[model samples]
Target: MRFATYLHDGVTHAGVVGDDGLHALPDGATVLGLVRNGLPTALAQGTRALRSPAVPIERVRLLPPLDPPTVRDFVAFEEHVEGVVASVGDGAGVVPEWYEAPTFYFTNPYALVGAHDDVPVPPGSRLFDFELEVAAVIGHDGTSLTPAEARDAIFGYTILNDWSARDLQRREMKVDLGPAKGKDSATTLGPWLVTADELEPFRDGDGFLAPAMRVSVNGREIGHDLLSNMGWPFEDLVSYASRGTWVRAGDVLGSGTCGNGGCLAELWGRGRPVPALAPGDVVEMTVEGLGTIRNTVVAGVDLPPVAPARPRPRKRAR
Candidate 1:
């Protein structure tokens, strides 16, 4: 079943998406609450409330399906890594350690925007890009879980658009340290979350879902691929992320950027010089089974310039 967090008549609500409309959960009960209580089972039990008249989906404003706990985005696509490695002309091949385990970076959770929200390009951002990927929301508590256990912990899936500022990212990555200021600028999730039970048929015996994914800019298709292209499965990523660490409900794990030109960097690697996002450009992404999320680029906060640095004092010691 599908679920969403939304605002209607100036009030925020959480509910299950049905053909008729959205069946509301009790006041203040969020999808995050459903994850903490255990998905499907707890959600089914909670449906008994069905807060008064179901609101038509179109009448309400959608928010990120879950109030994100923490976000960890993993680089699981070799195709994507190769494109980026080539773009920089660093002569760095995919590292040996990368092949040995799932590699990832933590991103800020506070900058999240929901479907259709306009993201302001941060000041001085020159190379704006969108990453098309899928994310699994953790529903249970576990530490150092087995792959099978990790697979079971997945509550649902949603599309993740890890909006990136290439210029800022390049500056930090050169130090071999961070994607922080670059990545933390913004991250988009939604259109809503679909429970795992709804996607069981798509997961083959190998435990991978071969969902068709794509992204579009201003109504023009830019990239497409199958989720099966990932070098690693979501379960492998979860097991790796939970190594000797606690993964609580509400944590999000992304499939990283899918290569088939899902990101502008990949297009550039192939000699397509697409311009960065200008004000008012709309970007949309969709993953099979998981719904589509569309966001618009908006004007940024233009703050006053910084003061000039003072000259250093002359040496005085003798």
Candidate 2:
């Protein structure tokens, strides 16, 4: 079943998506609450709730399915790494340690937007890009879980667009630290959430889902790839992320950018020279079975700068 959080008559609600329309869950049930209770319980509750009348799906404005407690995005696609590495120049390539484990970074959870919202060009950014990927929402809390256990912890899947400011990311990482302010502006998750059972038909053996993933600018298709192309599967990404830490309900784990031109940087790295996103440009990403999310780029306002920290006098240890 697909679950959604939406606005109707100036009020926010959580509902189950169905052929008739959007079935509102009782007692102000939220998508986060549903996932927190795990699928079996949520499904049972949702089934009973469907007896109520549904609102027309098109009439309500959709919101991100849930406000994640944390968003952990992993670089699990080798082809994407290879292309982006080449783009960053000095002829750098994927590192050896990258092959040893799934690596991820925490992105701001508060910076999330809905599927159809407008995203602003981050302040002081010119090289804007969109990453095409998939994400799994954690169904329950767990730490140090096995791959199988981690897989079971997933509530559902959704399309993830990791919006980026390439210029800010490059400058900040020079100190070997961040994608911070660069990436903190916005991340998109939605259309809605599809239950794990809904995607089982696309499973590739004991590996990743082989859903067809695509992204476009305005109306032009820029990239396409299969979800099965990831260097490490979702279970590994989740298990690795949970090592020595808890991943609770409403926490999100992204499958990272896909290969074969998932982002403009990878295309630029391959010498395509596609222009960065500009005001009014529309970006739409679609994953087979997961649905599409569209966001229009808008101009950002300039803010006064904060003073940088003054360098302190250094004293050598005696």
Candidate 3:
């Protein structure tokens, strides 16, 4: 079942997406609470148990399905890594350690937006971009879990647009740290959350889902790829994420960007210079079986310039 959280008649609600529209869950029910309670058990009880009338999908405004506790985004696509390395130059290439394990970075969970929300160009950014990816919502808490166990802990999937400020990211990452303010603005997640069972048919013999992923800008398709092409499957990503740390209910794990032009940087890396996103441009990301999320870019906040860091003399340990 496709579960959703939305606003209707000025009130927020959690419900199940169906043929008619959306069937509201009991009052006070939230997607986060439902996941904690167990998606399969709720499915067994059926939507009829809610007894709320269906509201036309068009009438309600969709919101981020779940307000995750944390967000971990992984670069699991070899092509994306290769393209970035090539574009960055300096004779860079995919690092050997990247093959040893799935690597990820934490992003701000408070920066999340919904499917139809407006994303702003981060201040001082001239190269705004969108990353088309998919994410899994954890169903329960677990630490140091095995791959198989991690797979069973997944509640559902949602489309994620890892909004980026390329120019800012480029400069900041040169300090040997990952993205900070460059990715602090907004990350889109929604349309709705489709339960794990819904994607069962797409699973391959290798235990990975094979879903078609596509991204468009203002109605023109620019990038496309398959979810199955990732260097590491969701299971391995989840398992690796849980190592020495806990992944609790509502924690989100991103599948990173898909290859074959998932973002403008990838294309730029390949020597295909595409224009960056500007205010008023619309970005739509679609993943087969999971659904689609579309967001519009808008002008960002302008603040006072930050002062540069002062240099400090090096001190040696005695």
- How many residue pairs collide in each prediction? 0, 0, 0
Candidate 3, residue 144: how far the Cα is off, in Å:
1.1
Report the C-alpha displacement of residue 187, candidate 3, in angstroms.
Answer: 0.5
lDDT per residue (tens digit) for residues 1-318 in model 3: 888889999999988888888888878888888888887666753466345678998898899998888999999999888886665433387889989999899999999998998998998999998998999999999999999999999998999999989888888788878889888799999999898888889988887898999999999898999899999889899999999989999999999999898998888888888999999999999999988888999998897777898897777765
lDDT of 2 by residue, 1-318 (tens): 899999999999999888899899986688998998889998998897788899997798889999889999999999998887776533488988889999899999999899999999999898999999999999999999999999898889999999999888887777776578888899999999999889989988856789999999999999999999998778888899989989999899999999888999899888898999999999999999999999999999787775788997786875
Candidate 2 ranges with C-alpha deviation above 4 Å: 88-90, 305-309, 315-318
User: Can you give the lDDT of residue 103 in candidate 1?
Assistant: 91
Q: Can you list the residue pairs that collide in candidate 1?
A: none
Error of 1 at 318 (Å): 16
- Which structure among the candidates has the greatest lDDT? 2
Model 1, span 1-318: residue lDDT tens = 788888889998888887678878888788898888887565674466454567888888888888877999998988888777666436475778879999999998898888878998876787888999999999998999999999999998988999988887887789888687778878898888888877777776767888899899999999898888888899899999999998889999999999878898877776788887878999999888887899999888786654567897787985
Whole-model lDDT for model 1 versus the true structure?
0.85
Rank order (by TM-score, best first): 2, 3, 1
**lDDT scores in order:** 0.85, 0.90, 0.88
Ten residues in a row with the worst lDDT in model 3?
44-53
